[model samples]
Target chain A: EPEVTQTPSHQVTQMGQEVILRCVPISNHLYFYWYRQILGQKVEFLVSFYNNEISEKSEIFDDQFSVERPDGSNFTLKIRSTKLEDSAMYFCASRLQGSEGYTFGSGTRLTVV
Target chain B: QQPVQSPQAVILREGEDAVINCSSSKALYSVHWYRQKHGEAPVFLMILLKGGEQKGHDKISASFNEKKQQSSLYLTASQLSYSGTYFCGTGPSGGSYIPTFGRGTSLIVHP
Candidate 1:
């Protein structure tokens, strides 16, 4: 089955540095989302993107976070400045329609030091 | 808001049954179920929409009660392979596309 794919399975970055997590959603999927899970914590929603715009975002998705669908297949999340608290497993997911369950990528583990 | 999952963890023997509950304070449009094995991505199990519907996959089934804003997952005749962390993602009323997932219920089934 077709699945969501993310690049850089793991990343280590210095605090205050910018990081970009990339995802290639299923070719026919229309809605894309980003979620994060701190170690030993529940997965938290960050943002949802549709039609090249943000549909909704959580408080965790503050000024430092932005998402872009720079191309037909690529959905990218950019963090302007990384913090220790930002270190977590960032997951990218996509759904073809409002009715289907989402397909999530393996996830990119972001480590900030 | 995130749903509250009951019984943080449970252990069952093969051929036993298990029930995991998820409750939300706000009205929900839908509830999604996913299972994650250690160090692996969560795999979607099923989705239950409003109006108290139920969906199932093989021996795994789930129920969503819109009136009570609650959902439950039922694992019947469980096997060792069923061991994993199960999460319920809830989408609140008013078209919230982003579903908030609960902390998860860790279940272990031994042979």
Candidate 2:
């Protein structure tokens, strides 16, 4: 089965530094999303992208965060100045139009010191 | 808003049956079920839409009740592979379709 792919399975960065996580969503998927799971917590939705623009975003997705579909296949999330609270496993997901399920990538574990 | 899931955790043996329930305070447009092993991404199980629809995938099935704003996931004849945390994500009608998930129901199936 085709799957969403994410790079930098694990990343450690200093607080106040910049980090960019890359993802390649499944081809032909119209909806792409980014979610994060804090240690021992429920998964939280960060943002959703469609048609090259942000469809919706949660409060957690603030000015510090941004997402881009730099290409037809590559989607990226950039955090401009990370904080300790930003440490978590970030997942990238994609869904076909009218599909019930969203295929998720393994995840990118971001750890800010 | 996030849904609430009942039975924080359950222990079962092979072939046993189990039911996990998820409820929301707000009306929902769709309910999605997923299973996640430790330190891994959640795997999609099934989705139940509004209008009181029920969907089944193999021995795992789920039912959604829009009136009650609740959904139930049923596992029949559970297998060892079923040992994981189950999450129910609920999306509100007329929203951006960004579904929020419950804490999760942990299932530990032993031999």
DockQ of each: 0.87, 0.85
lDDT at B70 for candidate 2?
95
Question: Interface RMSD values for the candidates, listed in order?
Answer: 0.8, 1.1
Writing each residue's lDDT as its tens digit, candidate 1 over B1-111 gives: 779998899999999999999999998888999998887788899998765799897899999988998999999999899999999999864457567899999999999
Q: Name model 2 segments beyond 4 Å from true.
A: none
Task: Note the residue pairs that clash in candidate 1.
Answer: none
Each candidate's B-chain TM-score, in sequence, is 0.95, 0.95
Candidate 2: residue pairs that collide: none
Q: Which stretches of candidate 1 lie over 4 Å from their true place?
A: B93-95
Q: Taking the candidates one at a time, how many backbone clashes does each contain?
A: 0, 0
lDDT score at residue A22, model 2, on the 0-100 scale? 95
Q: How close is candidate 2 to the true structure, as a TM-score?
A: 0.97
